[model samples]
Target chain A: MGTQAIRFVGYIFGAALLGLLALPVTSLVGAISVQKFLAGVYHPLFWPAISLSLRTTILSIGFVVLLGTPLAWWMAHQTSRIGRLTTVVVHLPIIMPPAVVGVALLQAFGRKGWFGTLLSAQGLNVSFTVAAVVIAQMTVAAPFYVQASIQAFKKISPDVWVVARSLGASPIEVFLRVGVPMAIPGLISGVLLAWARALGEFGATLVFAGNRVGHTQTLPLAIFYALESDIELALVFSLILVLVGLVVILVISQW
Target chain B: MVDTSLIVQVQVSLGDFMLDVDLSISMKGRLAVIGPNGSGKTTLLKTIVGSVYPDKGHILVGDRVLSDTKLRIEVPVEDRQVGYVPQDYTLFPHMNVINNVAFGLSTGGRRGSRACKKEIALRMLGRFGCQQIAYRPVQQLSGGERQQVALAQALVTEPRLLLLDEPLVALDMTSRRVVRLLLQNYLSQLDIPTVFTTHDVRDVVSLADSVIVLSRGKVVQMGTLEELQKQPCNDFLVEFLGQQ
Candidate 1:
């Protein structure tokens, strides 16, 4: 083949890969009528699942920011054995299978499991509870926020922090005024990714939290439940997730 | 004019290199710390500003003890009340010029409301003749303007001492003249002690009243430029100065 032909073939190959990924979402949308989609959206299962998803995802993001910010700042600025180990541990969830995360949470927090037994003895249970949904979501999503936060904090030159300190800005003041503002765009991207991950969490929530409507059944779990009985409800949940994902990506790219 | 003196006796180890420097200068204007690369000039400035802790000894500015290793008293950077303008300016890119300058005043509750702090920042920017670009973002500024804003940011707190690290290193020749003259004018007017590091002899000649030359993390010579010209401490000093 000629050079131009080779280039054209390569372009088509790349586009074909991209189209394969996009086809499911577009075809799913095209298959459903607007009226049916809206009706499914307003279904009784839909509202409860969405409310649970929103509650759990928002709380997970809150925890991630509160806990992950300090971890990221420290990890990015220091170079110790502990810091390196923490970085590796924080980044593992991004690549680890969600099912494995679910299994791990189950074994660690089940009624008869370690710490779970201790908690259960004290009249508390973590597995198969609403709190388990939050915990599972956090376990799988907090890493995304923390890893991105580390990158964000690292991008800012330490010299700026040094200058802020020299100018009499306290540690907290420097973080709030100088560090956070400088890395806002990256941090926002991290937050969006974490929230989306938590919203779409399935395997972990299913195993650890269990799919119970109005309790632990999030949107993803609702979609799973709908798959067995009503395909239309599942399609609506998938569509909402697709739209949200698009909006998030659009906002992040603009920022 | 009340005399302001800075006494530093510090010993620090920097990765297989020992940096021991002792000096006492009653600073009226600018005191230029001129040295070659790897001479620990920047380290000394960092020690004074509390970024790098000394393994031993103490630093005193006027009557205030900034660091005392023996007594286990070490004042943090925020409490030192020292204005620092680092090399390359390092202005907060997220803020505008006015806000960067205002950061020094408004932080740590030393200043009042935002409006009140901004008023002071505007006057400080006006002093440096860059008040027109006060609202411009720092990332959009030219090198010289960034340095000017950095200086204004450092000075807004009315600090007891000033530490400038290579203020002219990043500027082009055209802007270097402007920045140097601006710095000279400001240094001459400020009564507080000032210590600035530079490699250029011209900077030391025009901006500083006394010179401290460093070699291999140690002070090799300390005297006025006139005195150094009369008697060179060693061949390194003479060769580094490019004079007999």
Candidate 2:
């Protein structure tokens, strides 16, 4: 093909893909009248879902950062086979179907699942609860944070750590003082990505947490419920999620 | 008799290469390690600083046993009191020059307030003619300034031993000569043993009293530069000495 023809074809393909991706968001926003959008905002399920999503996603990301940071640091330093295997295992959630993740969570923490009997014996039931919602979000979102964190930590030259240690800083101190500060920008981006993932988590939460108004129903779950009864409410939820995602992307770009 | 201050006997296997080295240096001695690429020069320095563990070995600096495989005593890197400057200097990019130098004082067992540490760091920088750059961010400094800051950072800790990996390799030719003289002067005043790796013959001639030649992972020769030149070990060494 001629160069001009090839360029024209490339533009067509690129624009087509862009349009396909933009369609759902534009359609959602375009469909909403200000009256309908405000009515959806005032719906009883709206505030509960928003509050639950904010609470659960915040808790989930907090746990992810706390646990995943150290884990990523360890993984980044490993050169052995076990380390590579652990990396693959950590990333499995990102590729695994969210429904499968829900099922796995059920198998691990559901009343009839692996830890169920033991947990129940201690008078603790985790299935279909607000805590379950957080667990589901964490399961689906932890990998994003961990993956980004691994890259962040790995970018640091090994020499920096050695020099820090040689300067009389302990391993923990080196990690906190040198590693964390060096990796802060990458870590912040990771947190934002994980927060966005947790905010938009749906399939796993629906299956694991069981959508219930004011209790386990998060924004995504509420959107699903709203879609069945009122499409306008779903659009409102999606708009809010899109706005949150945009803010995250903006902050990440600043870094 | 010169008092022996540093002793390293270690065996490490890196993939297909094996680094089996045994050496001793006297107090305030400066030893330069020279080798081709992949010859384990940096690895030797790393082993001394407790960054890389040897398969079976012991490292002793002054009276402290930094590592002993048989005795199962391995002093962590922080407690080794060995200052190191890697090839790139690897200054902490997050902090300013004074803070970078003060890091050791604040984090180590030194009992000093933050202000006290900064004062000491600034004093050390002043000694290196870098006091003006104390508040400047590390990333904003030139290559020569980075070297001075790194040196100040390492020296401010009052380490028992110092290891420098290719200290002047990153500098331009003009700055290289300038820093070399600066290094020679400062290193002369230091009472502790100093070990540096360099491919440059000028660095070896000016800074080190003794030289150890490495090939693949083994030491080919260890003696004064004049002694090595009198009887070269391999073609690489012959060519290396020819540069002199």
For this target, which candidate reaches the highest DockQ against the unseen true structure?
2
Residue A245 miss distance in model 2 (angstroms): 1.4
- Model 1: what is its DockQ? 0.78
- What TM-score would you give candidate 2 relative to the actual structure? 0.97
Question: Which candidate leads in lDDT?
Answer: 2
Evaluate all candidate structures by whole-model CA lDDT and list the values in order: 0.89, 0.92
Each model: TM-score of chain B?
Answer: 0.95, 0.97
TM-score of each: 0.90, 0.97
Query: In model 2 chain A, where is the ten-residue run with the lowest total lDDT?
Result: A229-238
List residue ranges in candidate 1 displaced over 4 A. Answer: A1-20, A33-36, B1-4, B111-115, B229-244
Instruction: Report the C-alpha lDDT of model 2 over A154-214, residue by residue, as the tens digit.
Output: 9999999999998988888888989988999999999999999999999999889899999
Best by TM-score: 2
| Residue B150, model 1: Cα distance from true site in angstroms | 1.7
